[model samples]
Target chain A: MSIPINSSKAIFPGLITREREPVNLEFAFPTLDGRITPAEQFYVRSHFPIPEIKAEEWRLSIEGEVEHPFILTFEELKQMPARTVMATLECAGNGRSKLVPKAKGLLWEQGAVGNAEWTGVPLHLLLEKAGLKAGVIEIILEGQDEGTISEEPKAPGTIVFAHSLPLDKALQEQVLIAFEMNGEPLTAIHGYPVRAIIPGWYGMASVKWLIKITATATRFHSYWQTLEYAYWKDLYGKPTLVPVTEMQVKAEIARPALQEVVAAGSIYRVTGAAWSGEQVVEQVEISTDDGQSWQPATLLEEPVRYAWQLWEFAWNVPPTPGAYQLRARATDAAGHSQPDTHEDMRRTYMVNFVAPVEVIVK
Target chain B: MSIPINSSKAIFPGLITREREPVNLEFAFPTLDGRITPAEQFYVRSHFPIPEIKAEEWRLSIEGEVEHPFILTFEELKQMPARTVMATLECAGNGRSKLVPKAKGLLWEQGAVGNAEWTGVPLHLLLEKAGLKAGVIEIILEGQDEGTISEEPKAPGTIVFAHSLPLDKALQEQVLIAFEMNGEPLTAIHGYPVRAIIPGWYGMASVKWLIKITATATRFHSYWQTLEYAYWKDLYGKPTLVPVTEMQVKAEIARPALQEVVAAGSIYRVTGAAWSGEQVVEQVEISTDDGQSWQPATLLEEPVRYAWQLWEFAWNVPPTPGAYQLRARATDAAGHSQPDTHEDMRRTYMVNFVAPVEVIVK
Candidate 1:
C-alpha cells in the first residue's frame, strides 16, 4: 500500500524521514521546545498506511479471560470519567541513526520522543467494569493498521499491528484508551477514534487505531514482541534478543542548534530536555570539554512520572574563539545514565547514547 | 491619545502589562524558550502607535561631527556587509512587579527579556564609512516614533523617541543598524525597516524607527537620558538621578512556571536563564532551602556578552509532598551577584533581586 503523502505533508511540514514504505516521520528539535507538542507536529512511525475508520461505526471489544466480555462505542468511551496525563512517548528505535553497526529499520534521530497531554478513560477502570479473571497474565492490544513484515522475507505475510502488555502494566491507572490530545479530539493522522496510551513504555506498546483488547492466560507471543522491537545482544559469546520496554535515560540539546555560531567572549544559554520512561530523571549533567569534566544542570521543575523534564545551563564564553563539543547526559532514579557511545551494538534498537553537538564561537 | 491596541495585540499575545497608554508589553517567560523569539512574538514596549514608513523612501542620514555626512537608503543599508549577532534585549524595569515599595511606572514581571538573532550593518562600519571627525564625544540617534510622556500630569507634551550613545559605544563593532530579526525583515511592530541595536545595554538604548544619527562633540542629554530611565539614589542625604546603562546581573527561572504543581518523589529539573549587561555571567547557583543553602548549577556553554545564558540544576525532590521555594542567583565576571531583595529602593527600575518561585510537590 502506498503511503498517504498529502495527509502526512499537511500535518508534518518539517518532519525528517528515511523512507516512505511504512511512513516514518521524525520530529525536529525546534518543535520540541514546550512541554507538550501539538498533535500535527507529533512524530509518526507506522508499519503501514493509516487505516480509515469511521468513529460512529468503530467499537472496542474486550474479550478473552474477562468474566463479562463487553464492547464500547466511541461515545460510550468518552462518557466514562476522563483522566488527563502528560506523558513522554519514545520509539524503541530512537537514536538509530547514531548506531555504529547500522540498524536495519528506520534511522531515527533524537526527535522520536515527545511529551503530550493525553485525555482518556483509564484502562484499569474499563477492566474493572468488565471483571478481570485471576489467571490473566497479559493483555494484547490490536490496531486496525495492517501490513506485511518483509524483514524476514521467508515468513512475510499480512499482519495487523499488535502488542501485549503485562497484566500489572495493563492494570496501571496511567494506561488509558485515549481519544483526545491536548484537550481536543485526535486528528485523523493521529488515530482519529481511539488509541492505547501506555505510559512509561515504548510507543509500539501504545497501538494506534486500536480495535480489540484481549486478556490472555499466558504470555502473548507475536512477531512484534519476538522480532521487530527486540534488541540483539551477545550473551556469553552467544546471540540473544531482549524485548525493548521502558525507555533508558537520555538527553539532547535543543538550543544553540548543531553547528550554530555563537559570539566570542559572550554568554550563551544551553537548554535541553531529558527523560526516563519508568523512573524519574534524577539529574542531568553537561560537559563542554568532551566529557573531561561535567557539571550538574538545573532541572526546571519536578518531573512527571512519564514526561520529559526541561533543563538549562549558563555558560561563560572563553576569551578566544574555537569549536566546542557540548554533551548532556541524564541519570534516572533507577541509577541508570546514558552511555557515551553505543557503537558496539550489533543491531540498533535502544540507542541511548549521549550524542555530542559541535558549536563554533567567533 | 488612545493606545494602538490592535498593533500591540498582534505583536505581543501574552504580554503582561499595567496600562496601555505608553504600551508597556513585557515578554513572558514561556516564550523565552529558544535562542531567538519569532518577530511577531517579540515583546513590544512602544510609547506611541507603530509608525508606517515606506522602506524604499526611508533614508538613514549620518550628520554632525563627521567629515562625510551621508544618507543611505534602505536598499543601500542592506547591501552592506551583513553581520548577524545573537543578542538579548531586556527592559530597564524588568522586575518592577517584585518591588516592595512599589514602582511608579508599569509593574513588570520577570518576562521583560528576550534573546534574538539580529541581521544588519555594523554601526561601527557605518561610522567609519562616514569618516568620524576628531573629538567626537557622543552620537545621538533619533527615531520617528513621537509620543507624550504624562507620568506627571503637570508635564505633558509631544516628544520624539531619541537617545545618545557614548563615542566608545557607538564605535563598537557589536552595535548595528538592524533591518531583520531571526533572518526575516523586521516586522512593523519591531521597528520595521531599520532600527539601532546596541548590545550590552538595555532596550531603550536601541532606538526604533530610525531617521537620523548625529555625532556630537559634547555629551547630549534628553528626557529619556536625564529623567525617564534614570534611577533615583540618595547621595549624602540628597536625592540624585543616575542614568541606567549596562544591565545588572539577573537570573530567573523559566520552567516549572510560576506556582506550578510538581510531582512528589519525582526528580525535578530546575532550569532558568541568567544574564549580565557589562560583564559575563561567571556562574549560577540554585537554592531550595529558603536561602539556607546554595549549590552551583552547570553552565551549559560559554556566556555570550549582553545575552542571557541558560542554567540548570538537578534537584531530587523530597520524598514527602509539601511547598518548597526555589531561587536562582547569578554571579557576573565582576563578582557581582543578584541581590536577595530590593525593598529599600524608592522607585523601582532595576530590581535584579533573586525572585523566589514557590512550587507545590504533590
Candidate 2:
C-alpha cells in the first residue's frame, strides 16, 4: 500500500460509514478545531436507507390519548413559535466497532455523532395544543418508515419500529418537535419536516420520519422497537435476553491519529470530547506515565444544559526517545471516571473503560 | 418544510470526506449490500498532509541524546524485526463539536475516530537497532509536510501548530513505526507510506507525514506542538492553560435518531458507545426518569484495548401516550458513574457529564 501524500480540503462531518447493526463502526477524528461541527462535517449514522420526507406534505398529528387529536401541517407546526437549541445528536452505537471479541452490530470506530443548532416547535407545545387527558402516562412515537413484524426470525426478520416515553419527558420544555437543523430545514437523511429533539438521550429514543402518535395505558412491544435494541442476556448460558433503555458516561481522545509520528523536538496539544446521559462532566485528568500520576485539564464552556464538553491539555517533547503511556480520566459532577477493567459486568454491550494511550517518543 | 420519507441505511466506514473544523454536513451513502460499516467504509484521520515516502528512499534518523545517532531506511527498519498489533487510533477532539459555548476549534461531532489492525515494527525494536543514548528524556516528532508556522492563526487569533510526546510513551510496545493499517498499506488520509502508531493516546500526538524524529533533553515546542492544543485555566483567579496529553472517558448514543415517533405498543432498543483512557468500562447504566434512576446496559466486547465499546438496551412501551426521559451513565472498574454537573470542579474544559434525552411518547 502506498501512503497518501495530499490532504484534501473536502468538507468533513460525513462520518466514517460502517455496516449496520451487529457490525457498525466509528472512527476517531483528528481535527481539534474546537467549534461547531459545521453542517457539512457532522457524522451520519443510518440504520435503514436515508429517508427522504416530503416537506410540503408532512403532517404531524397530535392525537390518541389527548382530548384534542389534531393533525398539523408542516407549515402549521413551523408557525407555532419556533425554538432553537444547539444540541448534540449522537447515535447510540457511535463507537461500536472498537469493541473487543467483536460485536453483533455496526463496527463503528467513532464518527456516528453530530451536533447542530436545531430549530423547531416544542413537543410540549404541541402536546399542550392537543390538550392532554388525565391518566395519560405514556406517549407513543412512530415513524413513517414501515416494515413488518413476524413471530419467527427471517433473513431481515419481522420487525416494525415504534417507541414510547413517559409523559414526564414529553413535558420538559426543551423537548422539541424539530423541523430544521443548523438553522435550515431538515435534510432528508435527518428527520425532515418533523423529528423529536430529546436532548441528552441516546439516538435510539429519537425516531426519524415521524408519522403517528397514540396514547395508551399498557406498554408497547415491536420487534425493531424492543427486541433488537434492548439489552438481554442468555440467562446464564441460556438464550434469553433482556432490553436496554438508557445511556452511559463515556469519552475519547480526538487528536493524534494512531501510529502517526510527532516531530521529536516539537510540542503538541491533546484534546477530546466527553458526555453522559444523566450528568455533566465535573473534571478531566491526564496521565502521561500510565496511571501513576494525573493532572487536571481545561474544560470549554458549553451553551446547552444537556450537551457534551470539550477538553484540552498540552505536552512537551520528551528529553529522550523511549515509550510513553497516555491516559485521561473524567469525573462528573457526581464523580465518575473510567475503570481499570470491566470484568464484573454481565451484559457486555456498553463498555466505558478508562482510556489509555501507548506511544513511542522517537 | 416537509419531512422526506425514506429508508435509513447503516453508516459506512473509511468513506467519509474531510471538511473544515466545526464541520456540520450530511451524506447519503450508497451501500452494495446491507452490511455493517465494512473495512472499505472505514474513514481516515491524518494529521499534516499524507507523505509520499518511498520504501527505499525513506530513512529514519534517530539522533540527539543517543549513544550513536543512527539512520535507517524503511527496509532497514523492517529488517531489524517486525511486530504487529491490533489497535484503535482516536483523535483527541473527536467529539469537540459537541462542546457548548462553542470553543474555537474543529467542530467535530464524533466521526473522528476508528479502529483497525496495524502491522509495523515496534518502537522498541527500532530503538534496539539505534541504541538509546543518555540524558535523552524527550522525543520530538516532525512530519514531512512542509508549511511555515504562520503567526497568524486560522482564526483571527489562534495558536500555531507543532506537536510532541514523551520518550516513555514513544517506547511502549504498542507504539509502532507503523507502515500498514488493517493489513494493507496505509491510506493517504491515514498516515500513508510510514507513520507512528502510538496506541491509547490522542491522535494529535501521532503526527502524520513523518519526516523527523529527535531525542532531546530539553522541552520541544512548535505551532501545533506547543502553542496550540494546550489547555488553559484560572490559576488562582488567573488565566492559565496547558497542553492536552491524555484521553478521557466518554460515550455517545448511536441507534435512535432524534425526535423519532414510534407506534404505540412497541418495544424499542437504545444503544450507544463508551470509552475511557487507560481504564476499562465496568458498567453502563441508563435512566428513563432523568437522573432519578439508572439500569444496567448490555456491553459489547472490543478487540483493542484503546477502542470504544458498544452498548445496547431494550425498553417496552407503556400503553399510554406521554413523555419519557432517557439517560445513560458509564462506570469504570474504579467505580465511577456519570456526573450530574461540572460546577463543583475548579476547571471546566474536560466535561464528562452524563447526557440526558427527552422523548415524547404520543
State the DockQ, from 0 to 1, for candidate 1.
0.00
User: Chain B TM-score of all predictions, in order?
Assistant: 0.90, 0.79
Winning candidate number (lDDT): 1
- Off-target runs (Cα >4 Å) in candidate 1 are A1-13, A153-156, A233-239, A343-346, B1-362
Candidate 2 local lDDT, A175-199, one digit each (tens): 7778878777776656666777777
Per-residue CA lDDT of model 1 for B8-97, tens digit only, reads: 122224666645755666677744545566665567777677889999999999988999999999989989998987788888888887
Residue A343: error of model 1 in Å? 6.7
User: What's each prediction's TM-score?
Assistant: 0.47, 0.45
Error of 2 at A332 (Å): 1.8
